[model samples]
Target chain A: MTMPDSSASLPAAASASAPSTKLHAVAPTALPPGVRDLRLDFFRGLALLCIFIDHIPGNRIADYTIRVVGLSDASELFIFISGYAAGLVYMSAVAREGFLFSSLRVWRRVWQLYVAHLFLFVIFTAEVAWTSMKFDNPMYVEEMNIASFLSEPHIAILEALLLKFKPVYMDILPLYIVLLVFFPFALWLIRQSRLLALGLSIALYATARIYHLNLPAYPEDAEWYFNPLAWQLLFVIGAILGASTRTFANSGMDFPVPRNRWLLGAAIAYALFGFGMQFLWEHDLISRVFPHGSEAFIFPTDKTNLSGWRLSNLLALAYITAYFLRADSPMLRWRVFHPLIMCGQHSLNIFCLGVFLSFAGLIVLVEFSDSLAYQLLVNGTGIAIMIGAAALLAWYRAKERMPRKPAEGPAGGANVKSTALGGGSAE
Target chain B: MTIFHFSRRGSLGWRTAVMTVLLMAAFSPGADAAEATPPQDLAQFCAVPETVLPNGFLKHARDAYRAGKPLRIVAFGTSSSAGTGAASRADAYPARLQADLQERFTLPAEVINKSVGGQSARQMTSRLEDDVVSLEPSLVIWQTGTVDSVGNLQLEDFGRALSQGIEMLEKEGIDVILMNMQYSRRVELLVNYSPYVDMMNAVATQSGAALFDRIEMMRHWASSGRLDFDNMPRAERASRAAKLHECIALQLADMIEKAVRR
Candidate 1:
């Protein structure tokens, strides 16, 4: 019944270090030793694939994604993994380099994310515009909700630059950028006390739900699809776990998280309940028990505000995953699982690529046939391309680390080969 | 130097010839007419055929119009009918149609929008008793098939829901017009809407309901180059959409008027 202790299993090199105030003193290399966690990458990669499949709208394969069987979809998994990784990376930076330097580092990453979002925006708009013109169908632009940009370019451009006019599939990154901008404060609070940070996050989520607080969208008088106010709770919870693992490594003191049989049983029960409800809802059978208007106040699991049901379901799923799926599990070491690990390592790039690929998949589905073979072909090709891109990126990054010399090619290649085969630190 | 001289001269001559053809095509009268015709004014731009409506359609609306009583028509469907891309509720097809009908018949016409966003035919069917029939409308323009097709709902199930929904409305002696999915490149690329489109037409014919072939009409405008949705400048997209809605309304009005006169 014991919850898996991530800190207890850390490599000796990681646990040997105590909290230090010169984080940047250790030069920023491609990856720090003993920091890469396969578990994080594995789940993140899985989430990215689910997101890609789900975005195609009507693909038959989407039914197999986690959303059909669970209340919370890949969004929760993606954001949670991001937070966990951030906690590990930034908290270590804060402990080693001190708050000011680490905060700046976090902010720099935020800037990168913001730039990436804008880049995606430009490309997505162009894709829609070009396709619309080529096919002589204006509805593409409108369907993607970029009609505003077309109708009012000046104002639309200004609002988009401000991260206010996010179209479909483009909304998530803006929310992520906003969250990362505030990551430093969250990390600082967690460092002070994990419970304090968790408490504040829960309070904020509750307030948001009660008051309907959310950021506004530009062009459309609607709130952000993923309300940061509510979603920050999941992010903070992940950060706490991530930071606690690091804290245990530095101070040799574990965070007090009860891992009793009752807790495990409760988590299992809740997860089963969620799965059952999701199944019933999918079949349109749940209405028999919870008649439409009767459960109006309590029903219809809301994703935007991260409703109580969704949050609980996600927590249960997370608990089950943590309990069963250890980093050192033999199942994870299989050749088939390597792609997920690689994709997760290069998540940002793969995710961006996946978005475009999914759109292309959509186009193929619409223009071609909606037969099972076509759906499978489009989805399969898109995923294979994603996996291939990740592998190439991994190889390139590995190559960069090798010492340069014409005669040393075989030795350098061997080292890179071993790294890939061994599945060492993902970073 | 000799090779460079010949290549450069030949390239310049080819470029000049291509430019000359392009210029001629741009200035051609037919091309200019198609491109320049403002799509906003349907009466001016659209060559809508007379009697687009089926015979014996809109009997209730006609009777109401003749008796000088207010004609009630419900524009019922998913987001398009509810007006997702429209500038305003007034800019939606139903509103435009209401305005057109009222002006043409010289009688008060009320088009209630009972449409919901993101609802499939099945979901709409479930709400028919409350949303559509309960309103006691003389005519109901049901825009359907898009959501079901995009959602990948079973074709048989979709057909059943549509048939059931139409039966419920018609049983109340309401004239039903089945508006098929909008023709959009994005939608065309995303889902195979052909099956749903074909099924909708079959259902409309079998049920004796007027089929508003919106997709066909839109395709006509697009193919004729009367509306270049893809290449249209961003500044004019809103106006373009507004005009498209107005055009749909005008066509719908003509269909209703023709049916009533017959």
Candidate 2:
């Protein structure tokens, strides 16, 4: 590629060079790289869909669909995407505006996340309280004391400052904030050299795995539902991708097909080996090393440690996705894929609104049995509502971004309706 | 090529030998006999007593073990009487009491426990006539005060409701064993409970029903450090207490068993 022009659409030397160097022009018709990555969006949308299905009261399809697709529970997917998006967006900020700007941006996002968390915490607590009062059932109330709620204000303030809190049902935001706090450091290392970033990421992974140390998800006395120590690997991987994108894209890193039959045979054998390992793991063959039902061995397990099994599986999945479902593959461009893309596009708004609506919907239908039929009815309704919500959000965002007085299109003040229709890009 | 072949052959042979050894160990002759047997089932280890009574009030039940013509007793209370917090259901006081009755007397009796976790005396009382008395038990082990005290149930209401339960059981000639509340897991919390237990004891004495003072036994265990409530895990302590409770339960069961037999 030519040297980045100072007066180009992109800002400067560092900023323009990095993201562009990584993007491969497989399809001429594809959108610009910085504006949007369809693959990431598609994956995010797929995660949301899986999560919705899984959260439904008693859907039979959820179990089978999730296990097969590796998106059974969306906790890993959500957090993984969070890291990936942070790396993409924050890394860009660091490249353009330097460390201070990126650091401030991360802090701003943390504050926003904290506010969202607080709102959720209040809503859930109020709902539980309301339900308890109405039911007058002791069983309905779980660990509720007025002291608990009163204590929260002090803890939350401390958490906002220190980026730590005691593990509660609603304390994931603090963990994310803590992760993002290190973005400047991560970006600094990446800018210094790609090798340093790679080495640091590997070192972090090794430390977490070898020491088996888990940093506090919450305060000193709380259990983290999702251990950030293990989850950090996902973010690190994303950062590595963002940092070395230039090298990876230009280096002809594509997995070439085996010309010699022996290599293909070996690949098949190696795949079988992986499958064999899984089978043996399931049957408790290697009991001494890994006891069956070992906390680490569980599927999409409680993100405690980046267990070898899960990490291996993720690697295998990534390989398969890269080889078989590469960016410009016809499989990804199917008409059926549009819904998932929409969900991914409006993810933040959709997730927030969807989760709130789901809870409300469940409460409204509380008296109904958690039978198969009821699950179908609820899930069907949920899917429809999510679609409707996405459309509404998309429309609103589109309107907000557009100027009231439309500028003349290419034809000297001729009405430029085409840009509004098909050319509507990301905000 | 020759070196590679040799190395590969050696590794493969090693792998084969290891697998063979594992298979041999797993399926060797008389291996089944050599293996340790699984623990006996709950039913075999803990025999539920069976008995029949004239008016269908099961006798000799500390909690739900009755002996008579109908041979059934109902024990309805909170988690303690239900025999939770023990290593096994067989280790629960009610089961131990049933076994003791079986050994003491020749009466056949069955003890059915309808106790649930986190139940209060008032909740138990509300369901007394239906869940307990309706079972046509020859004996009713009416344990309530601990839950009532914890719940801060009105003492006047507690006494009246308990008396009402006793009256209902007695009308059917069902011997009622009024058990005092056991000591709390946290010894300091006992103060909140013991006075309520005493009130229950007073009602039992006034009504002329058999009294099993579990609070005294548990307090003794705790003070003597025999149960080690403070040092041990709550689960372990509960199990130790269950053994002590089982001993008292045995005596109560034997007394009822003899009366039923006579």
Candidate 3:
């Protein structure tokens, strides 16, 4: 199981050690099950919400997101967690049901993601198209970023099927879909030799950056927004950590908790350096410091190919996270976090719905008043709707599960032997 | 007093004069305060600070400028370069730049505006060979990001197109100056233009193309009460647009002269 037993006093019993406890022995030799690690759910849910707020352009709340503090943003967090959760679920399946059976399970999840992506594309297109036709502003059609799509729906549909017709915020799912396709192979490779898999992942990343290996987008001479070739490294790293039993609670990265103080200090220092870099941007003194803006000091760390700067910053943040986070911190049980956990549990639905809501929110801001009040309403209502939808979905799933044979019951918290339809299924 | 009949809104002094006029115009009943305002000597309004040196050395362009050779420059961009808001094509920055550079150095310079309306970086890149590379100009000022930002194009895709385009131009031995979006407070608030603007700077730094900070310049002008995009009267719209274009041309000429002449 990804977490220890949490059945009795679900939040408090997940772990016995204090977050600050030092000089602890290596993690308990006996790894137990029957615990659903809410840490994964918590972080994923937070990332999803950040994505939602960030997607809606001009949302003031987005300034507080990870983007301002670090080079990597929600995209890294999302992909990493996707890999981590997949590992926790699928690795167990591979061990119990054998390789071929687990592969089918992997393919099934890919299919689900593919279907979900296609549906999102369709729904988003329809939303933009309807707005383009209905809006009074003639510039509305162009500003919606679907001008080319409307001109040739037939070709656009073909391009979308090829995973090439992404228009702005639609790029996330395509990357996710492609990454999932590579997951089963990565899982199998890790099973062979973890070190070799890590080596290959890094090599592939380097090769992709050097050779500019990337899938092209349609209607432009540009490449995909999130290059799967480059991004798979992050996914693989996450998956490796997820599958390992040596990993500590609340730490998604494949690193031990209660790490040595020196290593912790180094990670904190790097994180602070990254934070300090943000101040150099867009400032008048930037020219004095870098003599050509900060890119000279810190290279173009654009989110295209997962630049080394971005990756290292993310790793440092993960290291820091592993140090402080605990599986069942009392803070996790607070009422404020309940919504985020629920949203995390049903991330796919919530993420898709959030994308749809972003478009609607943008239109409202543009077509009507873009006043402070509307912004407040837009963010407030949008989050409430996501949380409400998540709560309803959770209720509906619980009702559905009530009828099924509770063969494993709550004891099988992380049991992935239940097939693709009912594996760990955090995704 | 000479009005110069040009874009004279760059200085802090002129902004104060303009703001005073604006206030009088608002207060006076049916009075034409713009006409009533006195002529003013401008400081640095849209002025690129003298200390901000061009990051990319214009070695080829410099040598050409020093040799008294005819300098052929390509003005590649979208609407602003096409003189959409400006009164006429002649008043656009490229045409004005030819005049500004010719008068300053008395060197024959041809700044051909190869800009089309409503084109983004991707569309501009597609036309690089035909409209820009074929010209074999010593330099190209690529203005972009407004259309991309307004259209909500993927920022990553925008970055890719820009770097690729700049890299291609550099390969042809042409110095590139990347011009970012022209600013309007409404559009700035309506769309998230900062990322596109930020991406432009990042690309320019990486690719070693000098960035012409048009948005910040215009934004400074607005904040100082120089040219109010939102509040400009319809009667003065054409003149203001022309002045803005002229001021931009003056700054470009100054920067180019500094970059090349050292």
Candidate 4:
């Protein structure tokens, strides 16, 4: 998921430091009441849960995830939402504190994600190494792509630090990090003209596909799993939609919410087509009609280049979801979805925890019998852990924001200050 | 006699003659001729002990090759088979094996890799219909058990899934080669891998599939100093791994040839 930067929460501070420019004369769009939109958080939370289950490989729980019935899966949602959220936070920042401060804020977030990616790499490598050694299975390191680190410590570590080498599931974050690093520029371009930004993004994506362009992986002569050049289109689209939210707000305009019956019907029909196509593809029925040679041209679903089919499917799904699930819907506020909401609210932390937990879950599924009951227990337990961790983080942040006790005076103020510092470090 | 006379005439000639005799002794057919022989270039890398395949192994691949049809072999498994450590995709064992088979038999060959890194046997089983059976390959080399063992998956479930996968392949008239795990120093210490290996062996025997003992072969390489896992410098590891993959390709080709010929 594209993690929203600290600017998302500290909009007041951003507005307080606003420069007196003509840009500010238009008046900044009001920030969302809370740090997150409930709809975005709920879906992102669901995406995280799906990702956890999918990563476990042969588990029965994987069958129930959206990917089974649809062309676009959690990866699409995670990335799109990330872009949307980043646009929401940063654009609001830009509208308030001007472009310079907002860009710095986004870049700082990129740095934070990069550091987190490295930290995760080290921990994941250590986990594989420790497990392999403890279990007498050095091949596990090789299996998980950690053998390069062991065999070529200096080069591999350097490449990893440079973000050129990423282990298996560690790939997506690097994609997010790169996109986020360039997001400030994209946001600015988008601010200038949405059509121009979108046109540039789509043109780059097309060029990447035509030229087979991608960032090279170090040590291995392969390309990044999620090619930034191709994937930028989706992120840019999400961002543009997000930026439009503010642009519309400031100008007293509103985004068309798919109210037209024909548009809604088209969206449903498109979604159904995607589902049917994916089902046929999964069953290998589609291959009979579209041979391997013609498949790419006819229905290009290649994930690396983010093919046109995938993009269309994502757009259709997004449109349908947006039509059905408004941000302030009572269904979203229901207590049943609180876990997902909490998980979404604390996405960056929960995503990391989800990765580690998914690995742990795989081990559990393998170590124990992979019975239906056991699989359910494992998946259920993992979801609980993710939700619990999110809740814990939320509680900690809430406590940090609690007002100081008046009777305790300076000591209470000092305590709150230390707690806030601790919370910041925790994030 | 002439060579002996030349050797007596000069020390250099004598050295050349001795080396020639040793090479002949190594390559010539003996009472143990039924044992598979690695190609001359790969002899140094042949650390594996002698292994015998059941009669008619790889018959489908052989039949396809003989008919001048494309011999399709799917390399199915986790990272090693998926080309994780290989410098390039072409350097992967399956691709190298395809090259070897084409050259050896003078026929077109397609070695499709249906491996995903970090997948266990159970996961591989779930994907069989789409990844393997749908490819319509004549032969499948399934490198599994490593992830299952590493992940500590249930032995019974792993066995059942593996058996079911092999059964499905056999029913489709595809030749099956069950490749065991690669030897790893760290893994040897941390996991009791013998049970998993034994389970694969049993499965291969019961299902009439050939078992490619990669674990023992890799261990032999490490023990015989052919592959230096302990002290090799970090920078040279990729080259070393590439060499290992090449050696594996050579060994796999040799096994297929022996089976087909038998």
Tell me the DockQ of each model, to 2 decimals.
0.06, 0.02, 0.08, 0.04
Residues B1-262 of candidate 3 have per-residue lDDT tens digits of 0211223343335435433422323222212322332235333545544444334567668878888788889999887888876777898999999988888777788999998878889888999999999988889999998778766566777888999998898898788999987765334334457668878877876677888888778755554456655445566777777778877887888779888888
Candidate 4 lDDT score at position B181: 84
| Model 1 regions lying over 4 Å from their true place | A1-35, A135-146, A249-256, A292-299, A404-427, B1-73, B76-185, B188-262
Which candidate number would show the highest lDDT if scored against the true structure? 3
User: If you assessed candidate 1 against the hidden native complex, which CAPRI class would it receive?
Assistant: incorrect
Q: Give the 10-residue window scoring lowest on summed lDDT in candidate 1 chain A.
A: A15-24
Candidate 3 has a TM-score of 0.71
Tens digit of per-residue lDDT, candidate 4, span A299-328: 325666777767777777776776666444
List the candidate numbers ranked by DockQ, top first: 3, 1, 4, 2
lDDT agreement with native, every candidate: 0.68, 0.51, 0.70, 0.68
Q: Is model 2 an incorrect, acceptable, medium or high docking prediction?
A: incorrect
Candidate 3 CAPRI-style tier? incorrect
User: After best superposition, candidate 1 residue B195: deviation in angstroms?
Assistant: 23
Interface RMSD of 1: 14.3
- lDDT (tens digit, per residue) of candidate 1 on A1-427: 2222322233331433332213323424222334365778888899999989888755679889988758888999888878877886677667667999878877777787788888887766655454434443333322333333555667766877888777566667887888889999999898877767877898999899898787766644335668899999888877777776555534222221333356568889988888887786555455456643343332355677887788778777776776565433457668998999899988888988888777767655444334466678768888998999999998998677655545567667555544442232222
Candidate with the larger TM-score of 2 and 3: 3
Which residue ranges in model 4 land beyond 4 Å of their true spot?
A1-36, A134-146, A249-258, A288-300, A404-427, B1-262
Question: What is candidate 2's CA lDDT for residue B171?
Answer: 80
Residues A136-208, candidate 3, lDDT per residue (tens digit)?
2321223334444566778878988998877567778889888888788998897886667777998898899
